[model samples]
Target: MWFKHLIFYRFTQPFTLTADELEEKLTAKCFKPCGSQDISTYGWVPPLGRHGDMLTHSAGDFIIITARKEEKILPASVIRDALDEKIETIEQEQNRKVASKEKKLLKDDILMTLLPRAFTRHQTISAYIDRQEGWLIVDASSHNKAEELTSCLRDSIGSLPVINPPVKNAPSHFMTQWLSPKAVLPVPFALGDECELREPGDEGGQIKASKQELTAEEITGHLDAGKQVSKLALSWDDALTFVLGDDLVIRKLKFTEVIQDQLDAINAETAAEQFDADFSVMTLTLRKLLTDLINALGGEIDEASRGEYIEKKILEVSKKQQTAEETAQETA
Candidate 1:
């Protein structure tokens, strides 16, 4: 299946687990339906859904996995109504007001009682570990969901050494620069018609524009006024289109006709065959896209470079603080 959103992490060290080893580890946390009283249950599932029995699907050097989470849906209004009735009944019987502490306990008890009857919903997060590339790209729009999958993997396999990919330059800075007048975008990257711009600083407001020329005078006017691009829509070599955020999250991904034509040529009939073909194509395309993107944004900061960068930043901050303290002393 195609991922709608991507939140990827870089492995600090090489991932060494073989496909069989990883599969065995994941089985210990195989997904199960939520119990009657359980509020939520999360575990690994077969990436091929009902088409295959293996929880981990190996495509060359990539190992694809899926995590399923089933959670009970207890409406807040219903819970509030139930809690109110219970509290009223208790108050009438005892002739005393309920304290905040007791109200919390009552809420917990209400949840426990409601969970069994509450409707349950299920969602799955699919991700792949590109052992060759040292990246774990999750099909989740939010960081929390990506973390959930990574946490489960850590719990299953004992250790997961990954971090958000560090960059040599801020993405916002480069993205804004890309839209400036006479600025040429990097190879394979062409601007689209959507972008989000925001003023600098914590209190700065933001503006979102769609179906408008990103490099037009009207948009450049805002950039001249000190706003920076926070989210930008762009296409990579006409293969994929996506919105790139300042945090490096990719959203609103769409595959172009070129990719669709490739899939069509596969002429796969079965569900499993189609899935395998899609996975292979998607992963290969993504590897190239990510490589070009990282290079365009001034490349990823490796561990050694990151350590030096952090140290330099710390010293700069210390120097500024010292200067401020000296100024304060002089003023006093």
Candidate 2:
């Protein structure tokens, strides 16, 4: 599993659950197929699939959890055709029009009947919790989808101490400055032709430009005339690119050949091995890029704090692994 997107959040308080403790709690919520009568199902699943028993995959200071959502896909056209046929039969037999409520009931019944035969769609959100960093990173592109994963995790563990981290300096303001006349980016970020500019206040003007230099006079005039950038498309060292939003949500990611080429060369014997290699390559590259982006966005963080956090978390993880091994031995 290569992580595609990120929705970053910070923990407001300590999340002290050990790997064994978290695994035990999540086992009850492990994912299962949607039942015949149910339209959907949601639960935790092992990141390594069936190869791993623990629902949470722990690596040093980081633990990853995958949340799967399954939903039945009942076509509207099918339901409408079925409803029309039934309505026609009823009208012919009763020689009368159906009431509104009766029609609604009929539609509901049709949906329930079709649900069992409907195709199923599955979506999984992989979330990584950095124990020492106190961050819960979700590979989710949308806010509602990420919240669904958070909500499910809360239901399982009975607690979640995380919330969206506050952004001090607005991203729009910074992005506009970068695209301004002869602007030099802080470090790695560079302006691309793609940008969504919106006029602030009641006037409500908006426009999007793509594949055109952001430094064009027309674009600068809009910015000079008070249009704020809500979405700034940016690239980094020609290796990675993403749309940076006003809310700091990164979307529409495209990694260059430099990053993808490494993973493409990997030839693993098992699904687990391939997944691990893919994940390691992606995570290592992304983690560094994200750290730089946070700094560029003025999300000030102490380096010493990070070092201390990682060290402490690694020790705790080691202890938990040893204890789990001991428990297995005693059981044997």
**Model 2, TM vs. native:** 0.79
lDDT per residue, candidate 2, 1-332, as tens digits?
Answer: 65667788877677788878889999889999999888899999889877876687766667789999999998789999999999999999999999978988999999889888889999888988777767788888888898889888889899886656544577887887888798889777777669999998757899899888888999999998889999988888677888888877888877889887887888888877776776666666766777778778787445556455555645764686699789999754
Q: What's the alpha carbon RMSD for model 1?
A: 7.7
Q: Where does the lowest 10-residue lDDT sum fall in candidate 2?
A: 300-309
lDDT, candidate 1, 267-332, per-residue tens: 898999899999999999998999999999999887678777656655764696699789999754
In model 2, the clashing pairs are none
In order, the Cα lDDT scores of the candidates are 0.92, 0.81
**Candidate 2's C-alpha lDDT?**
0.81
Off by over 4 Å in 2: 50-53, 201-203, 237-239, 256-274, 300-332
**Which segments of candidate 1 are over 4 A away from where they belong?**
308-332
